[model samples]
Target: MSQEITAAQRQHPTRVASKPSSYRPEVQGLRALAVLMVVTYHIWFGRVSGGVDIFLLISAFLLTLSFIRKVEAGRPLALGRYWMHLFKRLLPAVVVVLLAVLAATALFVPRSRWSDILAQTWSSLLYFQNWVLAANSVDYYATDQSVASPLQHFWSLSVQGQVFILWPLLFALAAVIARATRVRFRRIVLLVFGVVFVLSLTFSIHETYTNQAHAYFDTRTRLWEFAFGTLLALAIPYLKLPRPLRIAAGWVGLAAMLSGGFILDVQGQFPGYVALWPLVAAALVIVAGQTGSPIGADRVLTWKPLIRLGDMSYALYLWHWPILVIYLIWRGREEVGLVGGSAIIALSLVLAYLTTKFVERPLRSMAWVDAKKRRSGVVIAVCVALVAVPVAGWQQGLQVQKERAEAEAVQNNPGARVLLDGYEDQSSPESPTLPLLSSLGSEWGTLDGDCSSYDDGPTDPVLAERCVGTDSQDYEKTLLVLGDSHSQQWLGAIQPMAESNEYRVFALMLGACPFGEPNSERRPECNDFNEAALRYAHELKPDAVVAVGTAAHPTEAQDNVVAGLPEAAVDLAGFGIPVVAIRDNPRFGVNMIQCAEANGDRGDDCAFPLSDKLSDSSEMAAIFDSLQGLALVDMTDLICPDGWCSPVVGNVFVYLDDNHLTKSFTASMSGEFDRRFHDAVHW
Candidate 1:
């Protein structure tokens, strides 16, 4: 939310016939408090503080108040002028912070994160970052060692920006309906927003229950939060309360809002019915507006210092997250301690004050820029270009470098051939690594096409939709690849084998779901997918079923076979199909490609001891001894040769992120994989 409602009011005053316009300092103080909650909870508690919800509510409240007054006074909405003016005020500080983040990312963050940062930069600049993040389906609650994206907090702002455009259209539609039907304007406005609040809240509850990670950033799921604010605005003018009840509500609401982060599991359960706790608390405080009692929450909220801080609340919110994230990355800490956190907050406050003074206030108040609608639009365009032009250029540069490196890899990179006994090193040591760091983000292996294109694909909808298949129309053998992304990554090697052996490959893989019997570890959807895949495999009766049989750990000493692999294998055996289970690859705690980019490619600093990542022998061998038609294939020697796994193997980057093997690296293992597969299946 923009946090410049007072400035907006001053710039465009609406003629109110019934209720005279009045400035609410308590609301500004509330914004200040919400921003502090978000910063402190993020830096120290590592939890959601419900502050963003308050911001969304307050934004809609002020917006509705402005538009409804204009509609009542028979004044033009001037929506085009409003959008340009609003975004002109919002975009300047956003552009500054995004540019700062780009520079910080280059200086402190690893190379692996640059592509994502660049993508998010464009998304943030264009106000669609939330959808981009939802499409990625990242778990916002994850507190792993993986560095947080500096621009991730922009999701809330993106949602607000989207609502700002849509909410005004909603008001315009209500005005049209009132004029056409001769209904009271206030009644039509309430009916429209009330319907939105109900429908959006219902969808929000359902979506959050089903897929919370995606729902957390979904604009549809958050629209109700904004609608609630609009509904409250419509009701507030007629809301009459006794002095005692208003005074009590003021204190009660403030207490509830303060206690929400501590008492609720906000990270795990939010943006659902549970979110009503904070929204209702905020509504109560707003309803308790200007209780004259000295002990009332309004008296505390209207403090002069809080009012001043609220003026810079948007800047503070923008500056705090990147500072906290970069600080944690630089210090190599999970959570900032009290002293460091204090320093971070202090630095953020200073920057926020300076940015508000120098950038936000000046642009909002610039008479020359604000004189004409086109001038405001020009300011918006310039702000977007300042960040987008450089980001796009950097992206193009990386792509060019990656293309050049790929061209040189054909003759220079030997990959797994170098691991074979009696193989001589034919290439010079100066050869560049295959799948260079610039191209590492696109290294995940994928099939030639989905199964829908094949005439002989599975009849089951789940299998047909989820499966990826080879292009071979006629083949001697059919091979089914099943399990999680680990199994899918092996397609780089498997596809080459299929071409040589004339085997048609169809892979049905789900992220994080190993091919196994239903278990507690798998989500309900994953378990259902695994069951569907098994039934499809039985019906197809492929010559052999391929799956990753073991689980690798980043820090564990001994790797083990997946919990239900043997059971799944036995079920497949019942259908007279052979199972060729590949051993899992080594997983590292750090990004290997990033390490290689930081240090020299040949340096030992990027190597991890094999003993830490995997066991010396395959655990699946003994576990599947009694199971008929089951054979184990272990390639740990090639992956982590000489008892130490290095990031680069024979001038090729091995792992894409921490665990997933790069397609180029896997393709290099085709020779060894071909030999092992024939020996396992004997087909």
Candidate 2:
């Protein structure tokens, strides 16, 4: 029987091959180093350390090796069982951190932030936080503030979790293909992943160049990083190097990895070709393996302390971000100093150790839980429910409050009406603002109508999609609204007036791109959008064209009309389309709503002098007089009454963030806006 077994093993060398040990102490140490770099850079430097990329590569490398080994051994893939088991181990710490974040948000985060936090909590729990962030990054109205979400760091883990589910299937498919074609499984995997690497890397480079913010979290753009790891795993076993070269490579890789964050702009130019810097460094370290020399990087990486920390690296990564964010909020600091950062790191380490010891390890080692796939699935469901139930309840409660607030606003919030001549302030002082602090997230202006009736829209897809008709199809005349987000917000004012006056209002607008002649300083896309909007306007001549003619500054003494506004107005006048230029509203350096909430909404300390927000004299006067078809309407007196602009005007929140007008406030300005429109256009 022994002789027969030996002969069978000889016939299938892979089945009984003496493979290199799957455990690598140096890799564990590398994990420890990578996570430390991430925490340190985030807390002190406010930069990305490129450590998450290393984690991604290592995860795929280990996963590919394990799956390939199982395939070679002729074992069942059991992908479903693997997924259940893997998430069962991963989710306990994640749940603990999420629940902690929920509690911290309630205690430290402001009411204005609760809605966003609630949404992110669900996204993080479901492992789709990366997609949520990518969508937000590209949202035209998304705030450009520097406030960081406590759950933002989960983007990488979300990406990793998604890949974990898909990568095993890839290996399984390769195994099937190999059997069908009578080829080696490793060669098939190499070919399949090679194509994935090439295609995904090319897409990543192009997308990163085109839209870096969205590309940063896009899974398609990140697949090549995982593919590169799988390819490295397939090639590592066959690679042979001299001892001295191995030693040199190990040291060089370690040095490069340590210096990568300082030398490269990882946050702005990552997941692209530039990402190869840290990836190649990590690959070199993996290639070095166990170079049996004292001076080799493996010697330092094999230290017992680092290996121990690596055991808790996942928990550490999860705990540190929330702690850092909460600390920043609690202290009102943008970045932490050495002492504060040290305390944050220390607290994170303690929490991570506790979580790993009491939560992760015990559940991972539970005998009954490991015995059945059903048991693991039950644990995952339970973990999800633990976070989801309370989050849903909180959201439902907030919805009730928002509805109540909206009803109250309809009854008592007069908004800009109070600034009108002979108006009375009848609202109770106890009544909350039009958009309650809890409901501030929904303050952005939106059209109550669509663009379907307009048959001759702009040919530019972006402009055509944005062209909205906010009135009944049976209209006497058409009014074209054009410019940037400032113009979009004014739709709140235009909609009511159009409905009453029997005018069809079509809004053609883009965020951050005011309608004008293209300039070298502006983004090429925005410039192109401007030119397209102009051409479209000339062709489809409306009765009148409304746009923001001026740009406001936060601190400058004089606000000026945007460059080329006069020229664009003159050009449009030639097409018989009268131009109504609405002077832009005041912009503040700080969040005016947040300030109001913080100061009891009395609008005392939050008020700004009109002198600082607007020019001493009208900058549009000269152009308004010179151009025959151009009419200037300045509502600065209404928005900033008594030469002072307040956060809350007649029980209504005026601005959503620092600049854009709240829809409620603009809606209340309908009467004043109509009077001004008629005075200017005589329509």
Model 2 spans with C-alpha error above 4 angstroms: 1-16, 617-623
Lowest lDDT block of 10, candidate 2: 1-10
lDDT of 2 by residue, 303-407 (tens): 999999999999999999999998887777788889999999999999999999999999989989989999999999999999999999999998897787777
Task: Point out where model 1 deviates above 4 Å.
Answer: 1-16, 138-145, 459-461, 588-601, 616-625
Task: Give, for candidate 1, the lowest lDDT window spanning 10 residues.
Answer: 1-10
lDDT of each: 0.85, 0.86
TM-score for predicted model 2 compared with the true structure: 0.96
TM-score for each of the candidates? 0.93, 0.96
For model 1 the TM-score comes to: 0.93
Which digits, one per residue and each the tens of the lDDT, describe model 1 over residues 1-683?
A: 11222333444455243465647889899999999999999999999999889999999998998997777655688899899999999999999899999899888886667788898899998899999888776532122226778898999999999999999999888877876776666788899999999999999899889888888899999989999999999889778999899999988888898889999988677788788888988999999999889988999899999999999999999999999998877766778889999999999999999999999999999999878999998999999899988999999998887887777775688787789989877766776788866555567777796677766677777667678899888799999999888898899999999998888999987788888878888889788988988888888888999999889888897677787888888898888888888989989888777677778778998998898888767454676565666788888888888988998788888888778888898999998999998988876
Backbone clash pairs for candidate 2 read: none
